[model samples]
Target chain A: MTMIQIRDVNKRYDDGFHALKNINLEFRQGEMTVLIGPSGCGKSTTMRLVNRLVSPTSGTVEIGGRDIRSIDPVELRRSIGYVIQSVGLFPHMTIGRNVAVVPRLKRWDADKTARRVDELLDMVGLKPDLYRDRYPSELSGGQQQRVGVVRALAADPDIILMDEPFSALDPLSREQLQEDVARLQQELHKTIVFVTHDMDEALKIADRIVLMKDGEVVQSDTPDRMLRRPANDFVRTFIGQKRLEAGGAADVAEREAGPDLGGFVMADGPTVNDVMVTQPAVTYPGRGLAEAITTMERRKVDSLYVVDRQRKLLGSVSIYNVMDSYGDEDKTVADVMMPVRYSVQSGTPLTQAVELLASHRLHNVAVIDEDSRFIGLITRGSVVRHLAEKLPHGDNGEEPGSSTGLGPQGGNREEHS
Target chain B: MSAGLSFFEFLGERLPDLLLALREHLTLSLIAVLIGSAISLPLGVLLVYSRIGWLNSAVFFLANLLQTIPSLALLAILIPLMGIGARPAVLALLLYSIMPVLRNTYEGFRSVDPHVLEAARGLGYSAAQRLLRVQLPLAVPYIMSGIRLTTVYVISWATLATLVGAGGLGQLIVSGMGVNQPYLIVAGALGAIALALAADLLLGWLESALGRRFGLRGGAAA
Candidate 1:
């Protein structure tokens, strides 16, 4: 269902600057539509037009099939949730009161408003009892932003307009909040129209990305389609494919494996978990050199990572070193094995994992959990395969099969070469 | 002294007259401030939001000019039109006190954080609602400061009412000076000073109380 419909919108400011030129768009219910562009690209102006913050110079904005201008602007805004870059939590009001503003304005009963405030604060991961009476100044930036989101959602408004809500936060807080928003959207499925200039943010959270430039939309498509099939040079340059390839490959590849992964892309780069091969060839420390070499040959890997009976990593014995003691049945693999210094946590981002491998000039690294138990191995070949799948070959020529089988392979790693 | 008494003796002897005069003096100041606040506050609010920039400036200029006129001269000037009594004296003081209340009211409403105002507007507050809930509350400190200044100024200047035949503490001073009685003059001067100080302290307390109620930074600075 169409939640918001903007038709033939044109906005000309008092200074004669054209802020929006014939914008025509429809935002669907239960989907997060992100309006993204460089500064002064009319994305903000477009968002403002929906809520009547800036009435279009010559067009109509409709929500739920009724023209927005026909409704009282004040009433329209009261029923539509709004969040800004500043978070805009009323500094003078306590968190509970701030979240209860709309409810109070709507004349809700005291008990109901109190219950709703608590419900919203809890929904956003803030303990209501702890944060309810605190002022906005008392909370940190991330906490304030969380309250800001809850305040917007307090009234259960059908359409929410967010204007760079997380831009002011630190990178770590921003990532965590982006996840929170994604998670919240999954549970609530409210129609959200978000305005942001950060491409990665748009790609992470948007169900449909509306790319704008110079007061007009250049392209509006899913993130996968936008990445693979840019409409023009402007969009291609704006997305910066070359810049992405140089440093943002893991981020691109992480999403590449699941184009339809709905909300925020979790990892900044692909994690070791994303590329690691579970059930890597292993040999017991008590095994002979020939026995270890035979297992390596069967798995077609160059080395055998030796483990104790509990599967904790002890060391690794490569085929090259095992050959020196080929005929010695008395010598166990542990005697020939070299201590493995290069290991990464399963959650370590693939970029850092690659760095560790490259610096040590190693072909593979053991993937371990916090308990030092070996789970898998991340190989250079797997990294290359993941990245190659994201590279644009031509317009709309995406290899749809490449990542189809990559989805949560379920307790076993099948050889796909 | 004319009555054959010391300054303290004169104060004791004229205690009844002094009390009557002090009451009249306070009555005149309070009436003038009340009238001035009632008239100027709404006008100040209207002027700030109104688009008639020239009219606002002209009204402000006239009030500023009124404030600069010598208080006695203005009371004297009003004497002919309104008769020489408390009526003309109150009128003059009202004119004198208008500017501070008006100017500060304008400044208070104007100085409300634009972002806060924007948030209010965006959240669908009507013009009246915004003024009453957001602007008025935030402007309390400034408005109270303005009223405090006006009250103190009016109380001190009420002595000039004697020139218009409106008897106050100034009667003793005028009569004492006429007969060259220094003690009576000292008594009157002290009474007026004490009244001014008392009024100032009282208004200051009110201002801070209002500030604290509105949560405007504990109200001390304002």
Candidate 2:
């Protein structure tokens, strides 16, 4: 059953501007639909119309097959959850009360409301006991956003409208919140209408994406279809062809290799990140060389990536480097570690990564996120394994001339590292 | 000059009368402020939500117009209508208090964060719910500051009621001026000033307490 149906909707402001042209769309039950475009593209206006915050100038909007204009708007909104980018928690209320606003308005008893507040907070990974009594000012930006999401979810509304809820957060926080949203959709199966201008965010979160431009939807399709076939030049630029190409190439590879390859296709091609080890042995910069050696020994690795508590990449120390500093009583790992100059983000293509590693004669490159936090590492071995897996029928298993460019001794030494 | 009494001796002798006048002055000031607040706060809320700029401007214009008249002039103007007593005196102070309280309430409503208001609206808040749950709580700091300012002004202006035989501390000044007793005049002037200062300090504490409850940093400072 369709959760929301908008037919022939047109909105014109009193200032003689058409905010939305004749739009006809249907939102399916239990799906995440993202409305995305640049500013003034009517995404938010469309969302507002569904909640009856703004009535359409012409045409009709129906929620659950009932005309929204016919129903009381306040009652209609009570059954719909709404979240925004600003995370507008009432400063005067405690976190618990902020989450319980709608429940209280709906006249739920105090005991039930309190229980629901705690349950929702715990679901979002915030400890209810520690956070419920605190004010909004006491929370970090991300924590407040978590509370905002839980507040919207408090009433267990079947439909939710989110307008760029994570846009105000830092990249890491935004990514985490995006994951939380994805998890919520998976677990609850609620009908969600999300509006954002970020194409990547739409691709990551949307079950179906509605690409808009200048108050008109250019195309509406699944993420895979949108990436494969853009309806127009505007959408093509909006999705950024380079990113599509990267995703498209991997997808094509997936198709040709059949479903047998399945998850391995993403790892075998496209980005160097495809072949990276996400949980490489990590040590802090202030540790003693003895400690670094022990960590490497425990992890069964020759080198340890050094990072601060925030996971900021400092450098790395290999077994050979630590051995060179043997018998040093007071020397910390920072004293023995080689400065890490070669690192790659997860988006770097496999070919570029291979060239970088070959040119620099490096055994590995640390993978860091935009914030320079160590995420993983792409090694010479993983790249070789991915290449080996990509070959159609190279099952002869002749060792593939270990180290494609390095000599025999060089190959063995690289293998040892 | 012929009266051989020191300032301390005069204060000691006139302390009881001075206390009675202070009590009268305080009663009149408090009553005016309480009544002014009761009238202005709701009016301010209505003006803010009315969404008619012209009506809001007209209301503000009339309130401000009343404020521009001198307090003595207002008292003189009210005497004929209310007839020389605490009614005329309290009514004049009430008119003077309206400007600060009403203006502050309007400003407080206007100054509420638009984003927070939008969030409240989006989350299914009815008009009354939004006003009570979000707007009023957030605007309390600004509103309290306005009430504090009004209370201080009312206390200061209450002394002027002596002109109409209302019998506040201002009577000492009037009688001293007539009889040429400088100590009586100084005692009455200082007492009125002290009352105003004391009301301000007390209201300031109340404002900050309200602010602290609402997590606002500058409630008392305003």
Best by lDDT: 2
Sliding window of 10 residues with minimal summed lDDT for model 2 chain B: B213-222
In model 1, the runs with Cα more than 4 Å from the true position are A241-417, B1-6, B219-222
Q: Write the per-residue lDDT of candidate 2 for residues A318-402, one digit (tens) a residue.
A: 7778888878878888888878888888688866776777788777778789999987666654554344344323333433333
For every model in order, the TM-score on chain A comes to 0.65, 0.64
Tens digit per residue, CA lDDT, model 1, B48-120 = 9889879998999999999899887887779779998889998998998899999989998898778677667
lDDT: worst 10-residue window of model 1 chain A:
A408-417
RMSD of 1: 13.7
* Poorly placed runs, candidate 2 (over 4 Å): A241-417, B1-9, B219-221
Give the lowest summed-lDDT range of ten residues in model 2 chain A: A407-416
Report the TM-score of the second chain of model 2 against its true counterpart: 0.94
